[model samples]
Target: MERPSLKSWAEAAPRLVAVAAGRDTADLVIRQGIWVNVQSRELLPGHDIAIAEGRIAYVGPDASHCIGDKTKVIEAEGRYMLPGLCDGHMHVESGMLTPAEFARAVIPHGTTSMFTDPHEIANVLGLEGVRLMHDEALLQPVNIFTQMPSCAPSAPGLETTGFEITPEDVSQAMQWPGIIGLGEMMNFPGVIGADPKMLAEIAATQNAGKTVGGHYASPDLGPAFHAYAAGGPADDHEGTQEADAIARVRQGMRAMLRLGSAWYDVESQITAVTEKGLDPRNFIICTDDCHSGTLVNEGHMNRAYRHAVACGCDPLVALQMMTINTAAHFGLERELGSIAPGRRADIILSSDFHALSVETVIARGQVVAENGTITVDCPHLDWPDHARSTVHLGKTLGAADFEIPAPAGANGVRVRVIGVVENQAPTRALSADLPVVEGLIEAEGAVCQIALVERHRATGAVTNAFVEGFGYEGRMAMASTVAHDSHHMIVVGTSRADMALAANRLGEVGGGVVFFADGVEQALVELPIAGLMSDDKAETVAAKAEALGAAMEAAGCKLNNAYMQHSLLALVVIPELRISDKGLVDVTKFETTELVEKVLQ
Candidate 1:
């Protein structure tokens, strides 16, 4: 699909002025709406908005002068006319859908803008992959900006990625049309230590006058955190506490509260503004990672804002966080974030502020969706053959590949177990004692075997560990190629045979999440693009994801959005424990540790 040639605001200013002065007619006009003024933080009833050439030409008490015979007028029915909501930070691959599908899914929910980091694909396909996502995003009718992935193997030396994002890559991407800023700098320790490479990447983005995204995934807000903030990250979304939010804003950095499919962080952090008297301007709401089910069923930016309102944030303040605040953070405030003159004519009409049931969605002067149905075509890229085939296990994995051999001459073993925390990114580093059967230590109760299978280089190496929390009962297995940061294949299950089957199935299908119980395949969501996203429609992928969740519950897992938890198990950057292609990682210590703690006789 050919991308639309971008028209500069200067080129359209003369016509916008003419329309506002009543010398020219607007292409579209919306009348009789209660304007939700994000900029002034007030509600103005009986307002009209006029658009010309996909940019707002006039906004005030009346746009009657700008209306002509050809003008498309929409009666808002006293609905709140809001600036289109924006997702300040997210990953399109997290939805398991490509750019086109993601836009299609969210447009109906009033998400007119998206700022996405394509690092998931960058880990598998590198610069070419980033370009693919960037180009496709530019073709969307709504705003979909790309952030050049700054970290591939997010924790360097902890794991290896297919390709690394260097200062040169960052510099080159800054020149891309859709590239908004550098993706989240997940190497917090490196930035704090002033690692030359990490600093160089941040410098390139700063030099280009672009925002440097942040990921300080630690609870330690000490001198280390201060040093990291000084190293040049513009915003952070890893905050899980009120103190974290206040700390970031105090340091002149935006505090991004994220509410993804699995991570519920708004209620804990929103109190910084709701309970405390902190200014809300510097606070942003984002969805760091959301799957297709969440997008299709719950909502997008609407979901985030509604969740914030539920957590006691003012309804108007929440809209500001999702709209102008995000736009200003990305240096796009004058272009797309608000419903003012010269800004993109992206607006939503809703009857209720609390529920935000999107009745009509407009983007760039076009009614894109009405009553929860998309009216425009979201173009797709013709993905090359290489992009579709990425999974490569050196050979067929078998039951033996997953076995964690017990320490020699031991009746039982004390081992390091990863404890997963529901509705959060951080895991717990735990110690557990389990009896050995034959030559292997068997995982019991809530514990399950986890193995990271090398897929990028097909080394046929598996790093085995134990994780407790999924509560699997039967001989069940789950495997996914959507493992965070590393993009490797993570297989977890009680039965080694089923684990082998699950891992091989993803390999055969190229990439996706698969579930198996009692040696039978139960559900699968095929993500054939770099093993991260599906090129199919969003609804199709959402249905598969929904089924995958049901199958997970049927296998005795009680965690909400367990697929997200399974996919993030390989995120070595976040504390306290994670699995990587190399070995078990103690994230708090930022190093690998021995799997077995002690030998029991």
Candidate 2:
């Protein structure tokens, strides 16, 4: 379908006004509400909104002049009318649901707009996968804009992905209808060094007059960061400290502080605005990656707003962070982010600013949601059979595949371990001594064996390494196909047999998460779509995710958001230690490390 031309929309203005003036009839009219003017930061009471042709035609004291006899009237009953929330940065696949289901889950929370990067899917299916996500997003009741994925392997040579995205691909995608901009440029090193491919992608986005997303995962805000900024990324979401937030804004990049399902970055970074008095407009709130459980139970962008407010930001400032600030940064200020003329008529009715309970939601002049229920349809795409049958294990194996063999005549060995920090993205690299049982190294106390099983192809390769901070006590295992970037299978366990059982179960189910203990499966969440998302309803997925969480705790694994840590094991871009299909990656030096120790012959 072709988009309506701007000139054509402007030509219809007289008809819209005629409908609003009662000469013709409006489709919907909302009456008697307090308008929360974001531009002026004032709550003006006793206003009515008249909608025609999916746009706000009139908003004033008395819409009785605008309301025709046939118009459907909705009494707002003195609730606060605010523009619907917008997420500045996110990954749609992280919700473990398709775009349609993700829209259904967040619409009740008043999130009407989202800026998404389907990089995870792009890594698996390439440009075609991105187009599939974009087409489905355009079919939703709310707005879900796509950013062409910039980094596919994320870090070149560190890991191998199922597909590769080139500069030509980036150029072609810039012309896509829903392509908002380039996805997060995660390869900061590439940008700083002026790699031709990275510069070409940025040039394409700039030539199209769109935004460029950023991901500088390093803590060094020195010359390297300056070089990255010079390379032309307009916004960044990897800031975890007040200095990080302040630096990004000073460099003319919007500082996006995120509060995802696992990442608790807002509390530490919001102080840049609240305490240090930095310009709040330069900072935005986002949930970069949220699970379906967090969206359905806790909230979506609403949760991010409440978190910012709880962190001492003004309530109005928090709301702006999730709305206008985001829209302006993404170059969509004229189309969204405010309850103003010519903007898409997406508004939310709430009772309180602090609590923020959405009573009603309007998208494109239509009643999309009311009283925590979606009223409109969000269309879903029929996924191809190839996408569903992605999980591949060469052959089902026993516990022997998970065993890590030690060096000759070794009784004890010192091993480098990846330390999982609770509720944070970066993990610490620590070394520990463990007892060697026979020829195999065993996890004695706080450490456990983590394996990255190749699931993209039927390679049947498993890379084993040691990790700490999960605090697993019993002989249990947790396996997941939600591994980031590469989207392989990650299994963490104290017992090899249980790990094997968990991995084989995921292979049998096609894709999902599973927990096993003492030769029995405890919980499983089947995500058959691309092995990254489930076709089930949000509530059903959340319930199963919650059960999986409970099972993780019951098996003696004690870490906040351990499931997130489990998913990120294959993400080689992040610092410290990670495992890929090739070998164990020591990210601190960006080199591959062998599982065995080097010794004199």
Candidate 3:
């Protein structure tokens, strides 16, 4: 089931030429439509598109010459015919579903192309995991390009992942069928410091003439930012502010504005194009980390595109950012992002540009979706039992495993707490004074206990710390194996008993997310595949995720998409504060720091 390659196109050139000239019939024809020409940034009315062999043969004012008795004709009826939307950057694992299920969820929303980074799998199973994901991606009906994971531990000396990706791995992955380039280089500090290993990974991707992704999470626009830009990353999607976006594009990197399940970064960064009037060509739209609920209930790339338009960007400008700009950024301008000749026939028919109501989707010269319903099957891989049984906790844990000892003879201790910011990724490093009971420190009012349990090695090692901003009360704990960058277990709770129970439950169910209150199971979403994704349908996973959110609310924790924040508590690459298997990391300093700053007098 391999699609047409360059050689196939050369072999079929004469047939396509005959079809365009009306000597032979086209396989499909779209007539009476307003064709959106993304290359020229204009819309041409009453255009006819002739398709043959899954590629566009002709696009003009009429296709009567190419029509035959057996040809399929789609009457666009004056609707706008746009190129299928493209997601410039995303991760399939973040949706809590496999690549097949993720494709099934987004096909109805008009996303025909996805540039995905499977670094989460790299952290778990290394190169083999990446290959599995890549093989599955190539089987889908629409396009799903894989990027070789560039950083596994994310930040060296600060965290420990189950597996690490080396420079040789990048070189080998470049030869993969679906590999687009190296994934996001999350180790910005390593690149700025001229780490030889990091540079070698970048060089491998560059040598293959592929794009290098970026992840500069810090807000500083100082010398480090310039050094990272010089290190060879071509685009970045981690900008959370107007300045961050401007800095990236100014440094010759494409600025990716994302609107994910929890990260509301588009409104702040879209100002670079909408208000400040920066070149829109250097900007693109993406959903960095969207869960199944958001993909099912809301939209995919369509959501980000509409958000940009609502933020005052021109409708055509927003569309270009999501379509042509994205394709051009990946060096795929000729293969996608337009309805002209010599491009893949991936088109969407919509009645309105403002609302972006996708009415019909044609991917690779075939009708794949119509009126918000999928018409084609998204193929799935037969994942082995070992892939589904990755959660390994050597021994069951008790309440004592989560306890933190206080300084001797101290009544209270001031501890550095990771503060969760609503609708953002970076956490604020704050300090809180908590009371000491007996010889252990106890969580006071708003502060709660957070622990990083090492589930990969099954050694039962736990690193404990404190955190705020979820506003959890009562005896409740939330545990997840979907911790970012490193797929370890992160448990945050007010009670140590509940924490241990929730963590042990994930190990029992293979791996997934669980919420516990008063030692009672409130909700669970089992992601048995590599402890990161589910094999179920997207709608089924979305429903379970919704229930998980409700359970978090019922436990007195109220933050927007709080589960997203919960998963990133252990991400040591992001700025400010984070926890890892090694210890608490001060990400800005790129080193581990003490949990307690000072002791009480």
Q: Write the per-residue lDDT of candidate 1 for residues 87-197, one digit (tens) a residue.
A: 999999999999999999999999999999999999999999999999999999998999999987798999988888789999999998888899999999999999999
Worst 10-residue lDDT window for candidate 2 reads: 1-10
Best by lDDT: 1
Q: Identify the runs in model 1 with alpha carbons over 4 angstroms from their true place.
A: none
* CA shift of 175, model 3, Å: 0.3
Candidate with more favorable, higher TM-score: 2 or 3? 3
TM-score of each: 0.99, 0.96, 0.98
Sort all candidates by TM-score, best to worst: 1, 3, 2
Q: Could you tell me which residue pairs clash in candidate 2? A: none
Backbone steric clashes in candidate 1, count: 0
lDDT of each: 0.93, 0.87, 0.91
What lDDT does model 1 reach? 0.93
lDDT pick, better of 1 and 3: 1
All predictions: root-mean-square deviation over Cα? 0.9, 2.1, 1.3
- Show how many residue pairs clash in every candidate, following the order shown: 0, 0, 0
Top candidate (TM-score): 1
